[model samples]
Structure formats: C-alpha cells, structure tokens
Target: MDYASLKQKLQAFERQLDATLAALPSRQWASSSALRIASELYEIGAFKNSGTDRAEYLDYGYAILASHFVAGEVGYQADISREADLRQLIADLSFASHYYMIREYLYYSYNVPESMSWSFGEGRVEIRFSDKSIPRQFFTVYNDQMLGSQSHFRNFNHSAEIIRLLENEPEGVVTPNFETADPLMRAEADLKLAAYFSLIAPDSQIDLGGYSYAQFLNVYRMLLTKALYHRYLARAQDAVGAIYMPEGQLLDGIAGELGISLDIGRRILKDLVFDLDAAANRVDATYFSLMREGEPGGRIVMRPHHFATAEGLVNMLRVIAQRRPQTFLDRVSNEIGRAFVQRVKAAWEAEGFTCLSEVSLRDFDPKLPDIDLLVISCEPTLGYIIHVCELKCPVPPRWAKDQLKVLNKDSVSKAFRQVEVLQRFLRTEAGVQFLARVLPKEGHPHFRDFVVALNHLIITSDNAGMFFGAETTRAINFRTLERLLSRSDGDMALIQHILSTYDEHADEALVTTMVEFQLGSLTVAYEGVTASPLLEFPQGSWRSSPDRQAMVDAFIADGAHPFDVLELHPPDVVVNDHSIRVTADEEVPKK
Candidate 1:
C-alpha cells in the first residue's frame, strides 16, 4: 500500500467525519462523545511522537488501529497486538472506513427505507441494516428501568464509586438514584454513553412496533451496557492467585442490598474506578493503550482517518462479539488448542492410536456434550486407553474479568459431567455402539481383551488459578504438553507413562461455591466527566419537560395550530402542476 497516498485519503475521510459530527445537534451527547474520542485519537502529534520515520508512524498507527480503535470497546485488544500483521491491519482499516461511512450514512442519509444495504465503490465497502422488532416479551415486561437512561449516566459517573461502595460500605448504605441526579453530570454521562451507542453498536435502527420515546431510550441503554467494559478484580498483592468473589456473592450482595439488578451490579464492579497503579500488571494491554496511550496527540501519533476506521471496525467487531462471544473468544482459545492438539494427534496417530476432535457422546442429539479432543488407543496386548482432553485458555486481558472466572468453573463442571457420561457409556450397551463407530477399521475387540484406562486432561495456555477437588482430570500447561508431545518421538508408552503419573492436586477452595470476601486497597477512582455539558433548554426553563404539555395545550386553545396544517387545515395557496428534471440527487426547488 502507498502509505503516503493512503494517509492523504484518510485525512480527507477524517475531515468528512469531523464535519458530520459537528453537524449533529449538541443535545446528541453520543455523537459529541464519539467526535471527542475520534478527534483525540486522530491528533497528529501522538502519531509522530513514537518515531520520526514513516515506518515507525505506520507501526504506531497499525497498533492503534488493531489494538484500540477496532477491538478496544469490546475488550479484544491483545489479540490484535500479538497476532495481527501489518497487511491484516491495512485490510481492517479499509473495511472499517467503509463501515464508518455506512454508519454515518445510516444516521444522516435522508428518507431511509425499512431495509437497505448499499456499497460506494465496486463492493469494496458494504453495510446492511435489517430492522429487528423488539421481542414481544421485552415490551410486555419492559419498564423504564430497561430504558437504562439515567442508569447509563449513573454508571458512567459513579461506576468507580459504586465499586468502592460495594467493596467496603454496606450495601444498604448506598442507594443510587440515576434520575434527578445533577443535570450537568447527566449531560456529561449522556455524551459518553452516546459515544459508545453510535459508534460501537451493530444495529442503529431498532424497530419497536412503532417508534416510541421509550424505545429510543431502551435501545441506547442496551448499546451502553454492551460498550461498557468489565474489569476483573483480585486482591491487590496477588492479582490472579485469589480472584475476588469466585462465586459472585459480592455482586449478589450489592444487588440485594442496593436494589440494582445483578446485571447492573456486575457492570459497576468493573467500571474503571481509578487509574491503574504503576505496578499493576493485571490490566489488559489493549485497555492500557486505549486509555493511556492510544490518543492521537499523546503516546501514539494517529491521524483522524485511523480513528474513524477504528470506530467503524469496532462496530464490526461488536457484531462478532455479540453473536458468539465464546466463539469470538475461542479465536485465541482454538488457536492454542489446535496448535497443541495438532501435535498430539499427529504423534498418537504415528503411534497407531486413533485421535479425534469434537467427539460427541450423545447419540446424535443436540450440539452439546462433546469433547474438544479425544484419543482412544486399543492394543491387543495392552487394554483400551482413552484420553478425554478439554482445552481452556485465558482470554484477552480485559475480557478475562469476573465472568471468565465463573465460565471456567462452569466449563470444568460440564467437562466432568461429559466425562462421567462417557465413562458410564463405555461399560454399558452404549459403549458397544460408540466403539463400533469410533474405533479403527481393524475390528471391534472384546471388552475383556484390553485394560480400559480413562484419563481426563485440561490443557491451558497459562497457569490458570483453577481449584480442583480430587478429580481425575489433569490440568497441564499447553506449552509443557506441546514440549512433552514433541519429545515423545512416536512413543505412546512414554506419553501414557508420563500422563499416568500426572498429579491430580485437589484444592478444597476450587469449588465455585467457595466465597472469598476480602476487599483490598483497589485504589482506583472514577475519572470525573471532563466534557462540558451544554443543555438544549433555556436556563431554568421547563419547556421541554412534561409540564409543557398542559401549557402547550393551553397555547393551542388560545391561538396555535393544534395539528399538521397540511393534513388538518387547507391552505389558500395552490401550486399549478409543473414538470422539471428529476434525479436521485436533485429535485425541483419549491417556490
């Protein structure tokens, strides 16, 4: 790619975006917040400060594009930082630019239809919008609480404080009132929430049977929660060893005592309350970059174009993250698992054993109850040796919050359950059916012919602080396993011997039901709103408030037109029919 030419085009795009953001009504906090973030990211000084050379600037821009702009919102930054190459970043930038333009068009393009998707140049860029009606159940149970209006502002403002309160203060002591909060604070909160909604959410047009004021509010709230990041809390001295609230009881306490739902309570837990302590290594690299370094004029020198594309790409990433966050997370998980499993499978196959992936235990039932990788070895002299392997890897840092802690426990429980079911099947009539299909083509062997040894293994990318009760499952590091598999030179006996001696250390604390209630000096403060609030209404005016409804009715009774004049009252002026050149871009000007 011609970096210089691309840079110029990017600058042009930035200018266009700036103009569009500036055109949005000031009351539109989301638009303004997005504009601020975009502008901050595009500052030229930040981009060039990393180095004077063109390549250096490109590298910096590439990092920001991958790490901050595109994946930062949904907390998927580290993946890009470690795995993405320059070429991939460029393609992403192009796609993101196109998506950005389409997003802008969705909001600004006039006379929008029910469903539409369009391309600007040779299908290089595309955007599709299909109207989704709110679930009928949603409307039935929907209260203004779901609208999350004031809640968004409250969370944006007091998330850090809320976390602190949850950690230290008794739950009943803190009662948060998102409504009737400071109007100025509310405005600033609105802008931040708005920024996330407009830029990050996949769908902009939400149909609610008919557009109601409440519907708009609810849609914005949903987007805000999706945009919000959840940071995992651990003890101050030990970041990962003893995670805070493994069972999520603290969140439950906060919910019960504070009257906030568990969902909102969870959001408050990870709200960026304070700046990371200099020594803290727990924060995700992507978050560190976006919050501390990625701004254009700061640590990274980025142009407006880069920021624009990042915004668009983040929305694109959000779609992926939203549809299947697990699969999206497994982007790295699968990579780790596949890399290790591929080696193990090849080695075992070379040793004359059958290795399979995604082994289903159910007799063609639903997609669940499947193993990640299963190895079944049958030797005439030896017995049947079955290795049921499941892989668990750490997600990108920000994504590895309290939710991951819960998910890990659930995964282990499910894996254990599946293994048990498989074990039971092996001794019963089901084992015969399973073996007939999965066994090698040699022949079905008698159950008594071989010694059946079943081993369950959990392979991890990192040293996960998982507690295991005296379970037969072995937790082994992927790197260690990869090394072991590599060195085992087609020796199935050596691998089996090593695994047979593998330690199954069980910790009583490993169960998810175990609760640890220790609040350390988290020492993070919620950064206050810096954006200047501009109210749409006149000072002390209630014109926009509900009280204006009665005043409006009175005014209409006195003199004002009560309805649309074109529909309700005929005008004296009439236009004679006249023909003029008509096209998509031009219409005859009215006199």
Candidate 2:
C-alpha cells in the first residue's frame, strides 16, 4: 500500500477493535475492570504476571479479561500479591483504580480517575491504544495548538469502531474530549495510585480520604510537580534523552510527554550531570526548600563579593575542620585554611574546571588582588590562577546564564560542530578568560590522581568509566586553556590583533581576565584600570584623535586615582584607596 493507504489500514484496524468491543452480545465491561486496572500500570511502571513468570500484557488483562480482573474476582491478583509478583501487585494496587472498563449487566463504562474514562452502562474505559504513547497525538496536535486536536480521530478508522462500541455502551455518553473536559484524570491517577501504594509505601501515602475531586487534583498536581522534579534530578540523563520527542518543549514538554515539569525536564537530559543533584542527598529535598519560596534560578555574584566583600550574603555553610585549634591563632588558621579549600573546590567546579592534580593552594596568596584558580592550560605552567568565584545561592551566573542559554540537545553530527565552534572560542584570549568564570569541572581530584588510583580499582579499564566521558561535559578551566596556549604561544596569531569587548563601565582591576599577563597588558594599554569619559564610549565607542589625545593627557595627569573613582570598589560607594572615601560608611572600617 502507498503511505496514505497504509495509514487507512491502521485506522481501519483500530475501528475493528472498537467495533468488536461494541458488538459483544453480553456487553459486560464495567465489572470486568482488569482492562482498566492493567492499562494504568503500563503508564507508571512495569508489572510481572502472577499466573506465570512472564510479565502481564495490558491487552490480556485490560481487554481480554477485563471483567474477570476488576469485578468477577481477580484471583490472579490475589495469588500474585500474596507471594509478590508483578501481575498480583498490579491487581492489588489497581483494585480501586479507575483504569478498567468493568462490565455490569451490559453497556455502562466508567473511567478510572487519572485518565478520561466513563460509565458505559456499568463498564469503565480508559485512554489507551497500542500504536503510541498518548503524547504522540496530544503533543503533535496541541503542541502549538493543544486545543485544536479535537478532530484528531475524525478520519481515523478506530473512531468509527469506538463510536460503535460507545453506541452499545449505554451508561456512558458518547464523547471524544472527556479528558480535556475533566482534565483531572492524570492528577486523580497520581493520587489514587499514591494512596493505594501508601498502604505498603515504605514510608507513607499522601492522604485524600474525604477530599473533593478538585481538592485531590490540586494537591496531587503540586505533589506530582515536586515528585517529577525529583525524578528529573534522580536520573537527569534519562530525562534528557526525551527531548527529541515530538511533544517536548521547555516547560510544557515534561508534563505533556512525561507528565511533569521542564526544570526537572531539562535536568533529566543526557548531556548533563547536575552537581546540584549530587551536592545534597536525594531524600533531603534541599532543592525544594531552597527554591520553594524564592525564584527557581539563582543570582550571579562576582567572586570577591562573598569571600572578601559581602560576607553576610553567603550562608547555609557546612564547615569542616578535621582538627580543632584550641588557641585563637590555631582557630583562625584552621578555619580560613579549611574554608579556602572548600571555596576552591566550589569555585573550581562552579566554573567547570577539572582539577588534574591535588595542586596545593599552598602556593596561593589571599592578599593578591585576585583569587587564583589552577588548571593545566595557559602560561606559568607550574600553575595558572583563575580569580576566586563567589558562591551564588541556588546557582552562580557563570553556571546559571550558560545553562539558561542552552537551546536543545543534538546528536553526534551536531555535537561535532558544536565542539568545533566552541573550541575555536576557547582558544582565544577572551574565550580563555570566560572559561575561567564559566565552565564546570567534570572529573575530580585531577587526571594525575585518577590515573594513579585507576589500577587500585581497575577502574579506568571498565566500560562504566567510559560512560562518564559520554554523559558529562569535561570541565574548561582557563589554566587548561592557558597551558594549551603556552604550547602554541607562537602560533596564536589569529587572536593577537582581535580584542574582546569587556564591559566598558566595569573596573579594570575587578574585571577578571584570569591571566596575570593579559590583565596587566590591558591595564597598561588602557592607561587607567577604569574607563575614561565613560559616556564617550558606546560599543567600543572612542573619541576623535584630538579628543582622545586630550582625554589621555587628562587621565595621565590625574595623579591619585583617575576616572570617576566610583568604579574602583566592588560597589560605587567604596573607593579603591582609603584616602578617597566620599562617606564614612563607604570607607573600609579599621581593624
């Protein structure tokens, strides 16, 4: 058959099934609830049949033995649940569920709670079909026009069969949009299933004994949102794999395809290994509480803010000191030392730089104008320093904005181009500095440590070890870029003349270029660390030769500190030098 003809055949076959359901002379579906019961289990989890070691099929229980399973004594369920098999567990759990179409005397059908079902005489029916997931239709149609899918099966062969079946189905009214009409089907299912399992739920079931349908749905929806978020965090990689589905969009995709939220939806995506998920234990639900009140995303605080400037802003700290320093000096030494290491790890990972070795912070100078980050790239190969990163609760901007900028996942071909385009940027001076502030570290304790420890566990040889490289993006530390550049220092001609746009209004000193040499060059080139005649520049906006010359002369002559001086401190009020304070509060307090 031609393509169109094939589609017709499929439609016709569906109609035949619908017709068969309609024509049963006895017409008993409501009481035979096994079909309804079995249908829902497929949506949530797997089921093993009690009658045999084989798994139960939805077709067998939901359709073939619908009446016997839901109403006429589901013996297989009892047999299975007692001993604990998949089929038995499904039967016991699905007992009161609305998924089945049980046969009363004849025609009525009622839906199980989560999906649209109706009372057909005394029977129940659920949204089910063999060809696809409901998302296939729901997503493709409503995707852009969720409301436009009403005519979905108008031309479908099964539509006619369903019409025939419902025609005989007396208790229920013939309708196509029952699901959209009630909209509570899925929520009801979540609640009902949760409640049923609650009896045996390792911990407990969320209660809904006397709640109204609306009430049950409302509470269940929120709980489901949380639970879905949990699922996303739990297995983000599996979640990410779903992005290619027809129904997948940012926020709506998760609920439409997977019946959940997108925040969790994207997290589940394969390309990522969410450190936030790892930072805390799963059962703790730390993300929920952190995010429940405020916005879902976090603010981007520059490095110096938390460690040096805004001490009060950073909180929720869990500090660890292996040994106690009973004396004041001992205490100060112990705490700051531990804290710096912790900060180093957070900073290292925040920017996505992998530590290739246990490069000691012993070489660091806290008094240096900038915090140091060590990596394999860049000059000064003995070490490269990225400025310290401040922890921005929820997430730092380096992590947050880059994450938000992600459009979607691509396969191998696109991945190659993406890696290629990005490497070019990373190789540049601008890109290297950005890497210092932006990337996240992937493998930990560095390559030196991992390789040495590899034989201890025979780890690097395992297939599982390869999985990490595939799943997670290896980190990009500026130091690593620096090292790469150090090797090719002579060949970096492409980037030599091209300058990157730094925020003109920002302080040159505070603006981290990561590399000491690069930053120093910029300062010398600009003459002053802060922008001159700030309003004069508009996108690399500069003055005419005479005007620029005049401005340069003025800047050179201005002795103490040039420019507005407001740009020197992290904030405008604080000045670069103690002598230029406009206000007492802005001055650094004396120790």
Candidate 3:
C-alpha cells in the first residue's frame, strides 16, 4: 500500500484499539491487566516466541503504549478478575499490538520494494524480502553490527566507569562529588548533596512531582533493591508469586537507610507511588511510577520488569535524567563536559604531550569559538602536527525514534563549525603566528621553518557512529582515543597517520552495496549510498557507480548464497608512522 493508504490502515487499527480499550470497565483495571499481561508474556517467553526476541517486542510495545495509551490517555478498563475477560483482553491487545507492529514496519519500509510484500495470519505477521535489495542487505548487516556494539557499550559498568571518572575529578569541577568506588554509593551521596542544594535554592530546584530529587532517588533505590531481592528469590526458589511489603515496613527500612524520620520516609513513599490520578493521559505516567499502592494492606506493589536486571535499573535512571528540566540538564552537561575535558587533559599530559584545555581564541579574534583542546606533537618527519580536538560528551539518544537524531547536522554542527574555524585560521599567516606562540619550542631551534600538519578531531564519550566522507568531521570515542594513545606511545607520526586516514579505514570496514543488472543488452548499475555509518540512505534513489558493480556481482554469484550474512571484520589497526591500507570485508564462504 502507498503511504497514505498504509497510514489510514494504521489509524483504523488504532481506532479499533481505542474502542477495545473503551469497552474496559475502569482505568485501574486496564493498568492491572497490562501489568498482568506483561508478566504472563515474561513467564511464557512470549517475547522470544517466533523469530522476534523479547527485547524487540518490548521496545515495540513500549513505543505503542507511549503513543496510544500514555499520550492519548485512552482509558480502557476491564475486570481482569474475570477469567474470560482477562483472556479476551489479552487476545485483543495482542492482536492490536501485532497489527500495529506490521503497519509501522510497512510504513517505514515503503522505500524498499522487498519490504512491501508482507502478510498477516494466525495473529502473526511475516515479511519477505528479496536478498538482492541493497537496503535490505545493508540493514541486515548494519543492524547486527550496531546491536553488537550497543550491547557492549550500554553495559552499566561502562556508565559506572564514566561516573567514577567524573567523581574522581577535583572537588570544584563536578559539584557534590563523591569519591567512592561503588557507583550506588556515589549515586546516593550525590543525590543527598543535590537535594540539599535544591532546598538551599528552592526557586531553582527541579520539580520531581513535589518530592525533592533526593527523596525520589531514595525511594526508587529502595524499590529497586526490594524488586531485585524478589527476583533473586523467584529465580532461586521458583517462587512465581508477587511479594507485597507493608508501606510502614518499606518506609521504616528506607528511613533507617537514609537516616531520616519515619514521617519523612512516609512522605517520600507517597511521592514515589504510582499516582494514577495525577499521571492519567501523560506520557511520563507509566515509567516514573515504579511502585503502586496495593489494596487491603497499605502495601507497596513494585513493577516486575522495572528492576528485573541491573541494565533495566540503569535505563530507568537514564530516562529520569533525560526527562528532567532542560535547564538543569544543561548545567549538569556543562559540568560533565568540564570533567571529561579534565580527564582527557590529564591523559594527554601523562602521555607527555603538551595539551591545552579550553584555549580561548577570542584573545586572537572576538568571533572565534574557544577550542576545547589543542595538542602539539613534534614528529621527526612532519616537525610539528597540531591536533584541533573538539570534545563532545553528549548523552546518547535513548529511544529508537531518537537514534537518527545522533547523526543530525544540528547535533554536531557547532563542533564541526568550531573545528572548521580553527582550521581556517591556522592556514593563514596570522594563524601560523598564533601557532608559533602557542607551540612549546624550547627543544627545537628550527621550529619556525619545520613542516606542520593539522588534524581536526571530534571526540565523544560514546560511539556516535562512523561519520565519513569529505564533508563530515572525524569523530571517535574516548575508548578508541585511549587505545590510539596507548598504542602510539607518544609517536606523533603514528597518531597523525591513524587520525588522517580514519575515514578511509572506516569506509573500507563498512561495505556499501553495488548491484548490476542486464536489461536486454544494456548493463544497469545501482550503487548503495549511505550519508553516515548509521546506514541511513536517501529515500527515493540509490546512487549509481558502474565501476564496482562487476566486483559486487562476482562476489554474490561465486558459489555464495546472496542471503548469507557477512560479518564485519574490523581493520587490524596499528599505530605507526608508516602509511598502511586496511580493509574489513572478507569473502563470504560457499554455503
């Protein structure tokens, strides 16, 4: 179906969902039913049933719920206590979710012909794709690579390491710093201080649904800890039943832990509980409510999935941070940038490089932006290579919809522009003079006449994906930079070589598709083009490059099944002065 037709279909299904939900008895019942269904899905491994995994299913469900129930506030209530009602509700929701999933998939995949052929049957949707399609092939390989990378980098330990680095910075650098090895301990201390700060400046304090940020964090931690304990119990003893703790007991425990009074703890508990009334029809409704007030005994009911894994806890915390007031986040972000720059400066100094942090170019020109970092390295061949490093420690995008925002020009435009300004300045006679003044020339007498090379770099805290081509600036993660530094061992030439040739290496590593077809006697070529290493392509037309079509055709037809997935082999990168070409595409083996 066309875009309009498919959108209409989606809207129709959405209306059906709304009608189904409207027939429910009460909003409370709907919430309970959703929770129950989620639990059942978890227990029966419904997430992993069929080819789709639990994570993907949950992601889709979360998106759908956030859009429909949360945003629209469609109160669909049902008496889940009735067996038949529960069963029918589950079946209805399941079918609606599956249908929505297919429609959403088809809607996004309209650009590719292969994705157009799909069928829904037996409460399941199946999509067929021609293996020859470049978009299909690119997405398959790119998704595998991205998933693997994301899994490795999104670990809690990785975040903890960054937190540790921030905490270790000088007292005035990262405010309310806690010098603790354990992330949880550090988090608690930081929250307490932040809460105190909030109280001191009530006018500027971030609103956490009436409770102080510290109180919110405290209650969340308590709930998460309890949920984790219950999860452990379930796993160890096969106890599938839900555990309810008395409100008084939970408050008492938190009060003791935080050295607060029972009254204060009780207030915090009230703040923490899922206020269905207050949050109704809000997008932030479901996620912020980790605990609900259980009926019959002033007990607390924790969401089963919120704290199921350490990763989940981290994700929830991340969401909370992201959802906070932008002003507060901006302040925190500035501090984080300072902390990261300090870390980078320290690392560079340790490596015996002359590194300048936050070098103000306004002294030279009022309009020029300040450089985050400037490194000067003296090489035997190039004499001196100046590295213009623009440091960015942006919070990685959380949702699937936000993923594309990472590569948006707006995100990195300032950094790129800053670097470009410096590069432009450096090429002038005044720039040479500025460089001569900035460069440490105590050892070398002939520094003035020595050849100089400038390498522009944008280094981030996390992998923001590969940005290649002439227009894009070279961006690398902190880990990669650390590796390069360690391997180079203060060799300027090696660093320059690697930094200069990074784009070429990345391009070789990620294979672009080139298809050839014989239309009668004429040969037509189709070249797959991607604007970024995120594997995003133009919607309407693929680029054409006839030169590589033969190679692609040969590679595909040489006893290798077109559908056989090709794994990305990272270049055997070595840090040295000598120029070397590295490619990551290995020939696929015959099936």
Candidate 4:
C-alpha cells in the first residue's frame, strides 16, 4: 500500500490492534512473543542507532514481516562491538515486545473479550481470553498483580541505559531479562499466565473440575514438570514447540544468552508454562539471520563460535577458558578446553560402555582426541572395544580450516593407528567393528555413577541421519536410554502407559520431587483459562520464583525496555542484555 494508504490502514489497524490486543488472550501473545512485536514497531516505536535510515527503520524488518521468532531470539545480533545503531535496534525491539503487559494473565474481567489477535504488517498475535470473560471463575485470580495503572503508560521514560546498551548488538543473543527486572518478577509470570486465564485451554474435566485451588495447583505443577523441555516427551504429544526455546539443532554465530540462570536452563522440569505449538514455532525460527544485521557504522564482531565452524569451535573454546575460569568444575557448564573435554566424554558415553565423560586414549595405542562424537559398543567375544564411531554437528563454521590444521597436525589417528575420526573412520568395518586402540581416560569426574558412566562408556551408537550424509547408528548411553524410556514411544503411546519419566539434566531436583511438594494442589477454572489441558501446574509452585524471575527481568519501568542495569529502578548491578548489550556507563571510563 502507498505511504498514505499504508499509514491510514496501519493507524486504524493500530487503534484496532491496541484495543484488539487489550482484548486478546494472553496465550496469543505468550504464543509468539514476536507476533505482538509489531505493536511495538507500529505503535510503541523500536530503536535504531543508525539515525533515521530505512535500513535501520527496517532493521526489525524481518521480525515485522515474519510472523514469529523464538523468545530468546528477540535481541538477536551478528556482533556486539562498535554497533551503537544496531544495539539501539535491539533495545527498541526488547522494549516493545516486552514493553509492558496490560493484562499479562487472563484475569476474568468485563472489558476483556473471549479471545483476540492483532497483526501489524505480516506479524500478528491471537490471544485467547478467559472463557466468557466472567469475573470470578478464572480471570480474577491475579487482579492484584495487573499493571498498577494505565497512567504508567503516558510518558514512557524509556531507559537511556537500555537504549545506550542496545547500541551495538551481535547475532544469536541468549539473554533473559531476569537480573535487571527483579521487583516486577511476579509480573513476568503474570504476562505468561495471562494466556492461561484466557480462553485457549480446552475445557477439560481433569483440571480438578471440582477440586480446591490448592489441590489443583499441585496437579498443575506436576503436568508442567513433566513437559517443559521434555523433547522426547514433546515427541509424544502433538503440542507446538515454544517460540523462544533453543532446540536440539545446533546454532551458528550466536553469543551465550544473558541474565539466564542455571535454574532457567536446568530448572525447567517441563515447558508447559505456555502454548506448545507457538512455543515450538518461536524456538524453531531461531535457525536464521533475523533483524538488523550488518548496517553501516553499527558493526558487531561476534566471538568465533557464534559463526559455528571447526576453527570457530576452537576459538570459542579458547575464549570460554579465558573468560570463564570456573568452568572446569562442572561437566555440563564448563567452558572451552574443559568444555571440549566434557563434550568428548559425553559423546563417547552416548555409545554403549562404562566410560567417564573424559577419556585418556593413552590407555589404548590410538587416542581418539580432538573428535566431536565417538560411538562404540562392546561384546565380550569381540573385545573390550567392540564398536567405534565418531560424529559432529556440522554448522559450517568460519574458522574451520585453522582448527582443522591444529587437529590434523597432532592427528591421534596417525599416532594411534586404531584411532579414527569422522566420515572416513566410521564407514570402515573396523569402525563398524568398533574395537580400535584404547586411551587412559577413566574416573576423572569427582562424582560417580552418572548416565555418562553407565551407558556410553561401554558402547558407541550413531544415527548417521543426524548429519546430512552418514551411516545409521544410535548409541544407548545410560543418559540416552534414560531419555528414551522417560517419554512415550510410538507403540506404547497408544496404550497410555509409561515405564518411567526421563529428566533432561537428570539432576537431584527431579529426584527430589521439588514440584510435587509445591503448587500440586491448587485449582483453576480450566474452562476460563487458555492453558493447555494436555498438562498441569502446581498451585504454589517453587517454579513461581524462577518464573517470576524470568518476567521481572524483562519488565521495564513504564513498560520500556531496560537497555542497561544502570537505568533500572535499582541500578548498580548489571548493564547487559542477553547478546552482551552493555551500557556506556557500565563500561570503564575511556582512557
């Protein structure tokens, strides 16, 4: 449409979009945090350090056009250094997408309708309001938590720190706005839970139809505990993936997420916090270059791993070691060299065998060093090393050649004839046969009896399908087996029976049954809320703390994005967004 026409249409649409948005269900916005993002551009205005250029105006061009984006990806950038313009662009987007939740939850109310959705340009959000928008059954659950007043929206003092901090952003940002938005934490969960009160969730009987709120909360948390990030579990249900989640697919050219805690990643027993399909779509979209990338003046030079090549992996590992000194402590969160050690160990363990996450090929002639995935299965007759295989997640990293040289120079395959890596190695009968050289990597970890120890140490498994062109093998490491058995398989699915549940991290928390003791008993008017009947959550959930943490971190003053921590209600702490969006004030004074 022409500017005048486009302007006219969008303006009318804006009014409608706003009113309609105010009327839609929380599930809709919760469904695609990116969908409602248009409202920010069309109504609230996004940021761009690039002055007033179309390139910048259109920075969020992709998001404006695309229907949704992964929640975590809202601040995506290709680099973080020397891109004030791009950083501002990110600041603008964050402010608008999470600006402020008018309703946040499906609190029963009169003005609110059954459900609604709004689209500005190609983007749109379909919110399902609480059924009938009745005042009591469900929507009224959190009226006390709604934004204090609409006047709060009048003169939006968008955080300068937020604007300054977002000036230069890099690609694949992974931050959650938790550290800065603390006081308003409960508000965060409210925004997401808003959809629950909306009308999307089916009116099911098992939502403890006649149970007390306390009783219903218990079952609710239990269902959520069972599904969040339960990929194998998700495989069984027809739910959609989350928009903001990182999936099984590896990413290229991205920085580690900001403000996220171990709890944010490891604490999720289930992702039943929001709509499954929308969640899936949001997360699945993370496989591309979205938003303002390579604009003039505003350049972002990302860490090597963000680009995802063999060399990039090496460099990222190096950076990780330089930056995170304590990574050596944990198998899962270790950085760089140690991370690689952990990775190799984990990969080898995926195959069948009793092995440590780390191995020393010194025990055997050929050491399988500097490899991505190693698979092997053992049979007493065939020998201790029955089968051997190696695999890698190929993302076409930029530094592939340099790292390759470092690897080939040492070439464990050469030193130890039996050792092998990649396509050439696994194709051979010896590869299929698996029993190659040995290494001296046993009992490195301080702890004992992890899945890494039980299943992978004994055997190697491969599903060549994991890569573009490869053979067929899938190992049964204790961890992998546990994951498999935890969820429903195709055959057993129809039976509605399960042998056991598989916890992703397999941490003490799951065993502790932390969720069961919390909101397990609370009840809600399932007919009124938009939550999925497929799962449930506890009434007084311990997760509430973290869930609140996730929200409060993002909710800014007057619904504006907190570009930096200095601009927050309580400053002096952190000043970076997920993709490393640091503020000038947070930077050391220039010499």
Among the numbered candidates, top lDDT falls to 3
Q: What is the C-alpha lDDT of each candidate?
A: 0.36, 0.25, 0.47, 0.26
List the candidates' TM-scores in order: 0.32, 0.20, 0.55, 0.23
Residue 84 Cα positional deviation in candidate 2, in Å, after optimal superposition = 27
lDDT per residue as tens, model 1, 1-591: 244553454455446544543332221222212222333323322333343222323323333233233221222222212323323333333333333333333432222233223332331323333221111111211221122344444545554443343343221232343222223333543555453323212333322222222333443333232222111111111111101122156545545544556665443332211112211433322232222232222222223223222322223223334334674464423444455456556655754567898677766445346777877766333334567777554321222132234235455445556666655554444454454456555542422222334566776443222333245655554534544554564345567656554332111111111111111221111111111221111122222346645764565466533122223222111111112212112222343
Q: Model 3: how far is 144 from its true place, Å?
A: 13
Ranking by lDDT: 3, 1, 4, 2
* Local error of candidate 4 at residue 175 (angstroms): 26
Tens-digit per-residue lDDT, 396-421, candidate 3 = 43332233344456455457777778
Residue runs of model 1 more than 4 Å from their true location after superposition: 1-296, 301-352, 364-368, 378-380, 393-410, 444-448, 463-465, 500-591
Task: State how far residue 454 of model 4 sits from its true place (Å).
Answer: 16
* Model 3 whole-model lDDT (C-alpha atoms): 0.47
Which scores better on lDDT, 2 or 4?
4
lDDT of 4 by residue, 121-162 (tens): 333322333222221112221121122112223343333333
Ranking by TM-score: 3, 1, 4, 2
